[model samples]
Target: MKLKTSFIQLPLLFDAQRLLAEINALDASCWRDHPQKFPGNFALPLISVEGDPANDGVAGPMRPTPYLEHCPYLMQVLEKIGAVWGRSRLMKLSGHAEVKPHVDLNYYWRERVRVHVPVVTQPAVRFICGDEEVNMKAGECWLFDTWRMHRVINDAAAERIHLVADTVGSERFWNTVDRGRDPFAGSVTENWHPETFSGLASPSPPRLTYESVNFPDVMTPWELREHLLFLLDDTRPHEQLARVRQIASRFITVWQEIWAAHGDAPHAWPIYREKLDAFEQQIHRFAGELKFNSNMSFIEGMNGLIFIGALGDRRQPTATQGMRRAS
Candidate 1:
């Protein structure tokens, strides 16, 4: 999610010792290579689709994997965050490894915020986002603007591990963020009190909530308009932007008319598909050369945010056909 600042330091801390212990208890085989096969990068799924650690797809009823069930404090840590989780994992970057800079362009991440809790990290580990860089200390909770170009680098010889969780964020979560500190801000919150999780606390299974409806069969006209406006706002000024806007306006008007007539009835899917296809064709005619300030193709963002899952079978979980990894 976009943020006013590049990074926000939430007022929360965890027991790094206990967090590391739980991670260490997991078998070496539990860690899987990065899906894109980035060298020296691996992730152990904590929360995944149907609790299957091997499943990386973001759409579905998320569940706590066996790995998460084994870590009592880890559950407590997430419970304290107060958000319905999507796809979460323990992201590990080995020494000298770096997460290449890229904006999270996936539809799933359009509204979701990625939370980072540095479990095992050194001062040399630098998280670079846009023009700012910060060394998130062990046990610190943070949220960064995933919409901006970001990457992580570990200069130390030791591996760096962080609990990376994704959520749309809840009221409680945002309330905490309201009190959070932006690193770029000149003044610090000297009296800020962070809730600390201690290992000595009694263990109790946390009743965590997971996301079920990530994407819909048909994108609502309101949502489609929002995505279009956001993309247009982010797009670099171009001669064709006015034409693209007009095309998008017409599409939304037609979409609203169809929605008013058919709502979400199964019979209306074909009609929706036809309109979406026409809209894409018309927009790309002029928007093909348009690009966002971040260097992402405008049409690519359009497909990911508004087109791919805009028309599908609502009776079943949405398919992950064109969904890109949010890396």
Candidate 2:
């Protein structure tokens, strides 16, 4: 489901002191690794493949990292979240650092949500998704729509740490969301505290001249593109696409034979696919000798030469012809 705000406050909270105690126990080395996706930033793994939080792609059989040992309470809270999780980690935004705004584009993110539980924060640390911004406070449980362009800034004097987890939502997760409040609708601003919250996009002006075909009437074109690329993925496995590819392959086969007849398909169905296959070997032999791009282009040119001439002879009747015959 599309979220109502830039961030959603799930109906769960942790003890600030206890969460902070475990967070403070963590050493500097855990956050030292170069981030895989968020380059030049810092993160530490809690539950992830090979215990590397930076390895953001993997979503199978994740286990707890050594750092998670310190926060049994945090793990307990995670268990209560009810999501079949992928990764959980601690992300530290050092003072004066800024996480550049970007949208996540990957298969893993299409159906998954990222949960942020702040363990350490200050007023100057701002979390911005699209246009609206807020300072996520310590011990607050929040979820943001990563499908949108979002980023973070630590203008405070100290590092800001957030316990973040990635998960494909569960029934329990949605239940919490249903019960959760809409903070944005209530006018929560940059001064947003633990006090209230939801629209990551509502109340904001809509961008039309735009068409959204994906999730119905609401999304703009850019949002739909992001949804298709990352969420829906490629058009592979589509029946029409499969048929198109098949025709493309057959066109190449039909062309090579047409060329051998010296640009003349004197016979109606005038191309032996077997002969075309053999001729393709010579095209491969002098691959670099072409005036145009590649042997592929040469094949395309052959198809172009044969295209109009190849049709019309003994052509099958259309539905119109069938209707006329019946009449």
Tell me each candidate's RMSD, in Å, in order.
2.2, 19.0
lDDT of 1: 0.85
TM-score of each: 0.94, 0.56
Candidate 1 structure, TM-score to reference: 0.94
- lDDT (Cα, tens digit) per residue for candidate 2, span 1-327: 135577787666666677777777777676754333344356777776655544542424566667876666666667656666666677777788778765543333445678888888899988887577877777778888664567788887787778878777668878887665555767543444442221122343222111111111112223323432322122223334333334435544445445545443435243433343344443334322322211123223222222211232322312111110000
Give, for candidate 1, the lowest lDDT window spanning 10 residues. Answer: 315-324
Badly placed stretches (over 4 Å) of model 1 are: 188-190, 313-327
What is the per-residue lDDT of model 1 for residues 1-327, given as tens digits with 9 covering 90 to 100? 878889999989899999999899999999998877788889999988898998887777788999999999888888888898988999999999988887776677889999999999999999998899999999999999988888898999999999999999899989988989987776566667777767446656878888888877777888888888998999999999999988889898999999999987889988998888888888778899999887878888887777765666532333233333334
- Candidate 2 ranges beyond 4 A from true positions: 36-40, 50-56, 187-327
CA shift of 118, model 1, Å: 0.8
Task: Kindly report the root-mean-square deviation of model 1 from the true structure over all alpha carbons.
Answer: 2.2
